[model samples]
Target: MVVDDHPVVRDGVALLLRGEPSLVVVGAAESGRTALERAPGLRPDLVLLDLRLPDMLAPEVVAGLRTGCPQAKVVVFTAHGDHHGVQAALDAGAHGALLKDAAATDLVAALRRVLRGERVSDPRMVPGTAGNQAALARSGLTRREYEVLRLAAQGRTNPEIAESTGLARNTVKTYLQSALHKLGARNRVEAIGKASEAGLL
Candidate 1:
């Protein structure tokens, strides 16, 4: 299974995986909602997912599938390598993290390892990871930022956050973007996720 919102990259990766003698591209979903709908039917042994999607956080994606298809091992394939990004996937029960820039051979090996019930991590993604707490505190966010972060962590859109918080939609977006930069996160998902690790949310 492959879950990514980018068509070109998703199709390209899928094409490569289809050539593996021991693997099959059982399903492809561009977003979490579709993944939840299709993953149960596909029953894939492993899932290759991106941590950022158009509709939901990747951790949510990982957690959701654990319920719908409890047996599948998930491998995160994403451009992000921030501490928050890596920890979020692991906390969501993912078996591994494969950076998007990793070689195809390495990606295959990670998949095999995860399917074998072992954890696989990209070394560069491991920034002296004593624990998520220390890493998250390094993000330096304020209480209000943490509030906005909690909603984003749950996969709410800027518009959704405005509705929930009574803030202007643009204000929510500004906070999310600012939070991302503050956390050294590449996206809203990673920022909010790191916040969760720090018990900020």
Candidate 2:
């Protein structure tokens, strides 16, 4: 199965996989909700999941897939390889991750490797560098913290965030402060910037 928001990318990937006699494209979806709704019915052995969907972030989609279709293996297919995104996806149970720029052959090989129960990632996105390692360490933001920070990044006030997340205003503030401290930011602006730089937002 292939899950990507862009029609071009979805069609392109379907075309690429169609050429492989050993592989078959069982389904495709344009949104995270649609993907989750289809997973149980399709029960695909492998899922090529785009990191940024129109309706859901990569981690949310990955977590949903893991819970809804535990038998399916998920590989994050993304354009941005920021540490936070990659780490979050992996932490959410993605078997591997590949950048959108990956060569067709590399993408096929990655799918094969993941099917064989091997974890894979593009070398460039690997957390081998000190900066990447540090970013990975900081990416341990709880789901609530991430939610608050993501909303805060959109210029939402604490009350707005609370209303959106269904949490109390004080709880929203607590999550925001925790996110800021974890991101080493003194203010929401700095936190948003850092989160963007780390690809958390």
Candidate 2 lDDT over residue span 1-201, tens digit each: 999999999998888887787778899999999999999999999999998788998889999999999999999998765435677788889998889998888888889999999988887653323344455456878766876787787788999777655689999899889988888899999999988899665
List, residue by residue over 35-69, the lDDT tens digit for candidate 1.
Answer: 99999999999889888889988889899999999
TM-score of each: 0.64, 0.64
In model 1, the Cα lDDT at residue 18 comes to 73
Stretches of candidate 2 above 4 Å error? 126-201
Clashes of each: 0, 0
Query: What RMSD, rounded to one decimal, does every model reach?
Result: 9.0, 7.4
Please list the residue runs of candidate 1 whose C-alpha ends up more than 4 Å from where it truly belongs after superposition.
131-201
Give the C-alpha miss distance for residue 83 in model 1, angstroms.
Answer: 5.4
Scored by Cα lDDT, where does model 2 land? 0.83
lDDT, residue 31, model 1? 94
